[model samples]
Target: MNIKLIAIGKTDNKDLENLTNIYQSRLGFYINFSIEIIPDIKNVKKLSEEQQKQKEGLLILSKLSATDAVILLDENGKQFDSVGFSSYLQKYMNSGIKQLVFVIGGPYGFSPEMYTKANGKLSLSKMTFSHQMIRLFFIEQLYRGFTILRNEPYHHR
Candidate 1:
């Protein structure tokens, strides 16, 4: 199955962008993986938190197709270890989904509509992380999960 990561805004840090790219490239070897970055909202200073989330959510939803199995990367969602995550990936593949989309929302989080549209939610960790840093972490984890599935040495038990 194809896996897509959708996140809002660009990574300003060059190092983080480079590292995220490395993992993204590695993922291509195992599956059809891609990241779609929704440009940051302009003039956020005037918008309320809820307003910003609504605006960002609209952009996020626009990237999705009706057939896409959308999963939100939410802090309050289910958490899984590396092995478990690999199995989770396996389940989706086994289910024959065309594209499994994971989204990382904007600062104030996803809007009500986004939550309603999502098939599920996953938490990388309970601890908060900057959205930019989360991009790198999530991509690396995706790579690790695939390696684990292949019984590669990339992930050591």
Candidate 2:
């Protein structure tokens, strides 16, 4: 199965973008991986938090295909160890899913509509992380999961 990461706004920080790209490339060796960046809403300063989430929700929903399985990265979701996460991915692939879509929501988090649309939620850690850092963390974890699945030396217990 292919994997896609959807996020709002571009990572303007050069260091973060480069690191994310490196993981993206490493991921390509194991699966068809892609990252889609939804442009930031114009003049967001004038919009309230709820309004921004609603707008971002519409854009996030638009990127999804009918068959895609969406997994949202949320703080309140179930937490798993590295081995558990790899097993989770294996289950999805074994289930013959076409695309596994992971979304990292914007500043104020996801809207109600987004919550309704998600297939499941995953929490990377108990600690809260900035959205930018989450992107980097998620990508690296994805890469590490694949390596672990293949019994590569890159990942260890």
Candidate 3:
């Protein structure tokens, strides 16, 4: 199955961007992987939190196709260990999904409409992380999960 990560805004830190690129490149060996960045909403200071989420949600939804199985990276969602996450990826592949999309929403989080459209929600951790940092973390985990699935030494038990 093809996997994609959709996130809001750009990563301003060069180091983080480089690391993210490294993992993203590694993922290409195992699956059709790509990252799509939805530009940050304009004039956010004047918009209410709900308004900002609503606007960002629209952009997120626009990136999706009707057949995409969307998963939101939400704090309150289910958390899994490295091996478990590999199995989760296998399950989706076994199910024959064409595209599996995971989204990292804007600061205020996903709008209600976005939640309604999601097939599942996944949490990287209980602790909060900056959106920019989360991009690196999530992509690395995706690489790790693929390695684990291949029984590679990249992930040590």
Go through the candidates in order and give each one's C-alpha lDDT: 0.95, 0.92, 0.95
- Model 1 C-alpha lDDT per residue in residues 1-157, reported as the tens digit of each score: 8999999999999999999999999999999999999999999999999999999999999999999999999998889999999999999999988999999999999999999999999999999999999999999999999999999999985
Candidate with better lDDT, 1 vs 2: 1
Tell me each candidate's TM-score.
Answer: 0.98, 0.96, 0.98
Which pairs of residues clash in candidate 1, taking residues 3 or more apart in a chain or in different chains? none
lDDT accuracy of residue 39 in candidate 2:
92
lDDT by residue for model 3 over 1-157, one digit each (tens)?
8999999999999999999999999999999999999999999999999999999999999999999999999998999998999999999999988999999999989999999999999999999999999999999999999999999999985
Q: What is every candidate's alpha-carbon RMSD to the true fold? A: 0.9, 1.2, 0.9
lDDT (0-100) at residue 152 of candidate 3? 97
| Order of models, best lDDT first | 1, 3, 2
* Candidate 2 to truth, TM: 0.96
> Which consecutive 10 residues in model 2 have the weakest lDDT in total?
148-157
lDDT score of residue 4 within candidate 2 = 95
Model 1 regions lying over 4 Å from their true place: none
Alpha-carbon runs more than 4 Å astray in model 3: none
Candidate 1, which ten residues in sequence have the lowest lDDT sum?
148-157
